[model samples]
Target chain A: GIQVEQSPPDLILQEGANSTLRCNFSDSVNNLQWFHQNPWGQLINLFYIPSGTKQNGRLSATTVATERYSLLYISSSQTTDSGVYFCAVDTQEGGAQKLVFGQGTRLTINP
Target chain B: GAGVSQSPRYKVAKRGQDVALRCDPISGHVSLFWYQQALGQGPEFLTYFQNEAQLDKSGLPSDRFFAERPEGSVSTLKIQRTQQEDSAVYLCASSLGGRGRRETQYFGPGTRLLVL
Candidate 1:
């Protein structure tokens, strides 16, 4: 089993601010993903970056597989982006693509 | 085209009663997963299914918890003799991974369960 730790457990930002969340894993993982849990509790898939970098509008993610770490960047944050952002990892030996999740970074974007 | 959908959105059950939650994965997706999320916490893995076969259920909290994906598409999680500790959000996710490491898991809205 792999252990995942997220930094800055809690964050508060004003609209239009920028924030960066980080995730670090204990072991080598082949896949890493970023998710956003909205206020209504829906887990929205944000990025599926196993390696390299990807961007979707105001959200972007970068995973350095060699370093066993990943970062999620929220630029010009909006109130709608306020929620729990999670990072999950899939180890090389896990069965059926089972994902082990981190404790999550709770972000509050105030208007 | 459809994403993962969960039923009953919310459930309230008395302690010691049984409850069943359902999840409908996306069409043509081959991998399914179930997770339990406590308040203000990330989702914890509960089980994994490949088609109709369950590959990993080690994350199940107790023997009273069981899940099945008989048709390889829709899955059900049944909790017998539930207790107050069972209160949490049950999340279901599905991906296109068949055998290898494909980690794109599209999640559902999740079913919030309350045991009193």
Candidate 2:
């Protein structure tokens, strides 16, 4: 079993602020994804970066496979971005894409 | 294309009752997953299905929990003899499948369950 730990478990900021959330895993994994769980309990896919770096709009993610960690950067955050950010990973062995999620970083952006 | 959808956005059941939750994955997607999310926590894996075959169910909390995807598209998770501890949000996800690196797993708005 791989362990995923997220830093800054809780964050609060004003609108237009920037924040960085981190995720560290214990073992090598081929399936690492970033997700945003909205207030309605919908887990939206933010990024699927097992390694390397990717950017979408104001959200960006970078994963260092060798270091077994990933980071999600929220730039110019908005009130709509307030929610729980999760990092999930599944091993290359026999996990069969079953993702194990971290506890998550709870972000609150006040308007 | 429509994203994943779940029925009965919320459910309330008496302690000894049985509840079944349904999930409809994205069309043409080959992989589906079920997870349990407790309050203020991330989702924990419960099961995985590749089409109609369940590949992993080690995360199931107990025998009271069961899931099936007989047609390889829709899935149902059933919980029998529910207890207060069984209350939580059940999430379903789907992804395009193959080997090696894979695509993102699109998730449905989960079903919230409450037992009393």
Candidate 3:
């Protein structure tokens, strides 16, 4: 089993501020994704970057597979972005599409 | 549905009671997954299905938990003799592909289960 750990378990920022979140994994992964869980408990997929970097709107993510770490960046955060951010990984050992999720980063962007 | 949908949104069950949770994945999606999330915790893998066949269920906590996707489109998770520890949010997700790592899993709102 692979272990995934997220840093800064709790975070708060101004609406216009920027923040960085990190996720570390103990094993090699075939797939990695960043998700935003809203207050209503919907897991919204943010990025599917198993490796390399990707950006979407005010959010971006970079995964350094060799280092077994990934980072998510939120630029000019909005109040609506307040929620729990999760990083999940799918390892090669499990070919059945199971994902190991990190503890999660609880983010609060205050307006 | 365009995305994974789960029902009922919330459920309360007594100890030793049996409950069934349903998940409707995206049409034509080949991979379906079930996850459990405790309060303030991230989702943990519970089971997985590739089409009508359940390929992996090693994440199931006990024999009392069971899942099936008979037609490969809709799936159900059954928990018998539920205990207080069974209280958690159950999530369902679906992906377009199963083999490639590029597959993106779309998650549902999840079902909140409270075992009293």
The interface RMSD values of the models, given in order, are 1.6, 2.0, 1.9
Candidate 2 retains true contacts at a fraction of: 0.71
Q: Clashing residue pairs, candidate 3? A: none
**Residue A38 in candidate 3, Cα distance off native in Å:** 0.4
lDDT of each: 0.92, 0.93, 0.93
- The regions of model 1 sitting more than 4 angstroms off are none
DockQ of 2: 0.67
Q: Which ten residues in a row have the lowest lDDT in candidate 3 chain B?
A: B95-104
lDDT of 1: 0.92
Ranking by DockQ: 1, 3, 2
lDDT of prediction 2 = 0.93
Against the hidden reference, what TM-scores do the models get? Answer: 0.97, 0.97, 0.97
Error of 1 at B67 (Å): 0.6
In candidate 3 the C-alpha lDDT for residue B23 amounts to: 99
lDDT of 3 by residue, A45-67 (tens): 99999999999999999999999
lDDT of 2 by residue, B20-84 (tens): 99999999989999999999988998998988999889999999999999999999999999999
Model 1, residue A86: what's the lDDT? 93
TM-score of chain A of 2: 0.97
lDDT of 1 by residue, A1-111 (tens): 799999889999999999999999999887889999888999998998989999999889999998999999999999999999999998856457878899999999999
Ranking by TM-score: 3, 1, 2
